[model samples]
Target: MSDAATKSDAAMKPGWTPRSAWAGILSEGSFGAKGPAGVTATAREDLGIASLIAPEDGEAALSQVVKTRFGLDLPTTPRTVVLAGRALVWAGPGQWLLVTENRTGFASDLQALSGLAAIADQSDGRAVLTLSGGKIRTALAKGCMIDLHPSAFPVGSAALTSIAHIGVHLWRADNGPNGAVFEFMVARSMAGSFWSWFSASAAEFGYSVHVGRG
Candidate 1:
């Protein structure tokens, strides 16, 4: 082994070690044996509609509005939920998702409510980047601005925030036994730039870039 490799191995003998193991795993080139190790990009244009009010009033409004607008009954319990629509995914507890679709005209329907709640048309303000691989979260921790531990953010949960200094919405994908994967919705204008930075941060972790279908 080269001097550097020897030293690297020696250092890892104890609890102290470099991130080379993680690096190698990400650099591997096997198909489904291990999916490519890299950051993949996808977009979810989320039209976030949230109803904030006193507990009693909000509860009644949520029940009535959800049934009237989407013909679905709201959950009685207080918890975060997601309602999947043909073009949109409605996240409960006063949250909804017009996922990966535009909501240019959806605002009109919301405006008709007249102070019943607050509606935010965030279609033009967000995009998504889906990062998948066994080492995905480990790679992300190198620069992510939020705590991504499963204990903190379980599956089917999401956080509206930023990574690598760019605004984004992050959620864990439920694509059946795929290990750990994350889908990030970032701003369209920042997509290209964030990709460059995200890829570089992932280099030491062995990233193989690809076009992902969500």
Candidate 2:
């Protein structure tokens, strides 16, 4: 069957409304004219995410498959690696999360690692949030227990932890004056609660809310 036919049939099938998990909480909001001193918050919806579990001692083989196919290396504990169009975050021992802009066939693509790994689609199960700017770490520190100091969680690092009591997969994507962008994935059902906590934490330094594509 053609890809178009598959897509058409999926669309024609009955389903619930495609509203964002953060539809009610995200929008144009700012504390001041310039918004937060040095912080910008963006929410991206419908991103492709998959959970990968590689067999014991198969991390190397799995990494090879990822590197060959996606041009990215499967990161080890507490790290995230980004390629031209995809990113891989270490989720746990022998487990990783794959993120990409295109959700189509993502989970299937990992079949290259077939005998060595297992894949599960989490595209609709979570929401992506990005926090950037000079004071971004400060804002995160308000509600998160993790040490945001550069010496500790440097750029290209990832952590599976909780923020404001909400579980999340967090990672630092960059570092610079206008850099230091951190991307995190939170459960769809907890997006609203996370937003509430984020807002309160960012209030002191002010903040801007951005909706739509990340």
**Top lDDT hit:** 2
* Residue pairs that clash (backbone atoms under 3 angstroms), model 1: 42-128, 81-92, 83-90, 91-96, 127-185, 127-186, 128-184, 128-185, 129-184
Candidates in order, TM-scores: namely 0.55, 0.84
Cα shift from native, residue 136, model 2 (Å): 1.7
Q: Superposing every Cα of model 2 onto the true structure, what RMSD results?
A: 5.5
Q: Per-residue lDDT tens digits of candidate 1, residues 63-175?
A: 57656765655533322334443222334455554442334445555565436555555554554555776567777887786677878766655666666677766666564
lDDT for residue 167 in candidate 2, whole number 0-100: 97
Best by TM-score: 2
lDDT tens digits, residue span 8-27, model 2: 99999898887776787778
